[model samples]
Target chain A: MTKQLRPLMIGVVGDSAAGKTTLTRGIAQILGGDATVVCLDDYHRYDRKERKELGITALSPECNYIDIMEQHVNLLRLGQPILKPVYNHSTGTLDRPEYVAPGKLVIVEGLLSLHTPALQRCFDVTIYLDPDERLRRRWKVARDTHKRGYKPEEVLAAIERRMPDSERYIWPQKKAADLIVRFWPPYGYFDENVDNRHLNVRIFQRHTLPRPDLTAVLDHSHNGRRDAISLEKDVWSGGQPVDILDIDGTISREKAAELEQVIWEQLHFSDQLHPELLGAFSEGARERHSDPLALTQLLIVYYLLTVRKHRPVEIT
Target chain B: MTKQLRPLMIGVVGDSAAGKTTLTRGIAQILGGDATVVCLDDYHRYDRKERKELGITALSPECNYIDIMEQHVNLLRLGQPILKPVYNHSTGTLDRPEYVAPGKLVIVEGLLSLHTPALQRCFDVTIYLDPDERLRRRWKVARDTHKRGYKPEEVLAAIERRMPDSERYIWPQKKAADLIVRFWPPYGYFDENVDNRHLNVRIFQRHTLPRPDLTAVLDHSHNGRRDAISLEKDVWSGGQPVDILDIDGTISREKAAELEQVIWEQLHFSDQLHPELLGAFSEGARERHSDPLALTQLLIVYYLLTVRKHRPVEIT
Candidate 1:
């Protein structure tokens, strides 16, 4: 925050249950207390019951105070404070607003972070979670039931209801993203598979923003099989050429740590950050780690830090 | 708004019972639907009960979220909306927050509008209300007892407790004001006099910002006695020389209307605004209008519109 620098802003946008929170939580853990993670649910224009009565899905820009969202992000970029609105998830009501002052890093994660050009201008780098549709549905059901107290059938119904708005207002933002993160289950795996933790992670680094050089680690890493962490040229779903870093879910933590080491060297702040704190997920009451997820977070961090090297505080 | 102009910002600041709300309301009414009057109590960090238990008065910057106030003002100046905190004065509790989008004129009235350099930068023009201490004390007792459910002695005690902070944090802001407005009863009148409405109004034009050319009307007008509306140059208590516009409350509505006509001619928007709507005040359930108040509001509008003439759409 010193040295006359505006906080680095990173946007994480995705459809519901696309692992946005998990990714954001890991990034926050790595960035530690200096990162202020803003969840966009706080901008909801209608509480749950109101939305149901109005028959408006939350994914619609009309269902949130999008203008206020733009204003809050712009204020955060100026290193100013904001009295942010809060939308309660468990109770499906609007909670008391909270005052948040921007820290060294501002990570805005939500369903429609890139819904408008004004919002897009606030970020130094943007990541869009485009997880496999089936896997996302499963995650949504699991999350709603476990955390939000929604029945599985109700969660499914909500997903179905949200599909149109999600497609219209949320998915198109992937084209505007600097990086696209997609997690997918392995072949022949069903939704209830216990090995769902082994879902493979793929990160598409578009040329819109700078990214870490993972090709070096992939070609020569002293860990598991070279294929465990690999980079391949690919055409993005958005019709752009991109470099996709593939992290196998079967990859060992040692392999993931080795990959992270490369990014840590680029970051130059590894000692202050604990790599072990990354990729933390919960299995019922117990906690588990996903190496693929850990590597994905490391790549995102590396990309975030790269922005500093490319442009140091040209923020208005 | 369609012309891509940033809203005009006029800051009205004063200590408790200096008539900030009355002045602000008159200005808002004159500006019609295009004015947004933001009361400063929304930024109170502690509710009334909390301030009592903590033995902290609201005049201290520490007792309020001054930084958030600065942030919200800056946002409003940018014509962006804010989820503003609401401190319920009647109940002395923090109520539900409200979303406020700026209209053409954003009139911020508060106890500490000019308290900080950042807050000072948000205004196009700033006003400080500086009624005589005894008169102000009477106003405070009356308002608290009538509107906030406080007994007369209890209100007086609270005022006594707040005096130190008021002197420390509130009064000094007068130095930053563009216009210093003071309302005082005529000679020999006590607090309970029915002729309190005949108080003289003095507005000190500090030349910190552009003001309407009021001297033209004072020197020659079509109504009242020669000295009913007069201008005098005086040395400010802060040591600066200022031109004070004095308005005799005893001046008839015809005299006030003549003065308002001069400002209206300068404003060029008289066709859309009704002078009759100005100076509205509530005495119990009855509405009353003070000619002195009406003339004051007209002068404020004249100063506000003059800003557009001096610097148009240069807001950053």
Candidate 2:
């Protein structure tokens, strides 16, 4: 007569090219193969031609079955399997629905994962990537032109055209997030020629959940003054306060290792988390690297594990 | 036909009990005796009793002569005099309008100084006080119950009643500010027994104005981690990035003095800005204090002096 326990749900919501996929991939790698990633982008009701003909961008909620997504999220939260719709990104067409079973961890990531309150409430942790607009546009251009076989001008035009819908749909969901991850060029280092490796990341820890206490690991002596990394208490617009943890792109390998050790020790997992798997991202045999990306993934993993440790015995 | 030099205008706007007067008084004290402060609260068309009778709060635009205030601000920016309305807080009645001439520095502090684009454009610098709601309510309750002769219940009722109007009118003006000053209880120090001197202050330097370069004086080594004072680059909710300068309440006198000296040296004023005068505020001969408040005042003074030094030769 006992109810079955559900998988731990994490939601990652952001605009196109806001690094949602990379973030999800990193966290999944850290959690090992037991994690399942569900791309809500697969729920797109229209193909590229249909969207173009209708003059509607993929960012618009009207273009997606939001209610179905919400229902699926609720079902997944109850440890149930669902036939999820699939949309092919490279082919720009709808694919057949696939049966997706709940795993130990379910990471739902896409433009509208947090658009509805019901969907938002389903996740134990929700993250929104909010990289600088200029940086995001550059990422989009690089991604669409190189991988998606789109001309540079077409990608730029699509981005510009999607701005209104992005503002209305994707951006507002940022407020609902438990954590907001923003990647930008470091202060005084913003230049047209800056590399992605040189971009700093800021993680805004909203007061919605119990955040990991980094006091033991944080070098208080080098507090807000250090260029490598810092954590600060801040207030958001509308007066909602948050804690901002900033990681510089120039963080030394030694510093990164030290930080990783602190977080790993705190997690107290019986199976030690592999350090190398934390920030690993690859593209066609080429490895892309970022220390900030690793730390962010580790932080999300910490939250997931904390939820698992604290789950009610009855549910288990 | 010689053109006259205009007064340097600074606007301070916030909701009631958001500490507008204290901020203005400190800045005026630092600027010496010649500075003139104009209370835009004086421009209220309806007296306290009248507002209550009409079921209108003081926060609403309709209850105040915003047009007259805006016109007067324009005149003051041009060093012109105006017969400004006076709302006597002690009597809850409107007195005869008084003729006021602009000094070298004209500080306009009240609820709606930055409400209109016309009014906002008149100031060399515009500041908005955005104290925490809980802390601000505590301040309001204390002030209304003591100075304004309102019952505790009455004050609480008034705050609740004014919420809709405050939202409609007062909060919207925050977006127009060049700097936002937020005073709050530090994280984990929100006990009822905590003293006001122990509160933290955060200054959001918006992208509206070219902020003073404090890199030479700021201890960047301490970054966002110092127990006393720290400065950080941060992003606002709507994705407009800002530099957040945080001042801890427990900042040592020595640390405060050292910071003050660094700022003063950078100003290079022929008439040395007095350290004691910088952050001075009084309550019935009992001198109340805060190091963060002093530093904030000094920063404003630096901005004012910078504008003065850079004014066109024709205007001078």
The model with the greatest lDDT is 1
Off by over 4 Å in 2: A1-4, A220-227, A270-275, A282-285, A310-316, B1-316
Residues A154-193 of candidate 2 have per-residue lDDT tens digits of 9899888888888889889988999999999877776777
For each candidate, what's the DockQ? 0.57, 0.00
Candidate topping DockQ:
1
Q: What is the C-alpha lDDT of each candidate?
A: 0.81, 0.78
The candidate maximizing TM-score is: 1
lDDT of 1 at A154: 100
**lDDT score of model 2?**
0.78
Candidate 1 ranges with C-alpha deviation above 4 Å = A220-226, A236-239, A262-266, A314-316, B1-3, B49-53, B220-226, B237-239, B313-316
User: Candidate 1's residue-wise lDDT over B167-272, tens digit each?
Assistant: 8988899889989999988666754774545678899898677666776777555343446678888886668888888888688767677777777776856677
Q: What number of backbone clashes does candidate 2 have, counting pairs of residues 3 or more apart or in separate chains?
A: 9
Across all candidates, the chain A TM-score values are 0.92, 0.92
User: Which docking category, incorrect, acceptable, medium or high, applies to candidate 1?
Assistant: medium
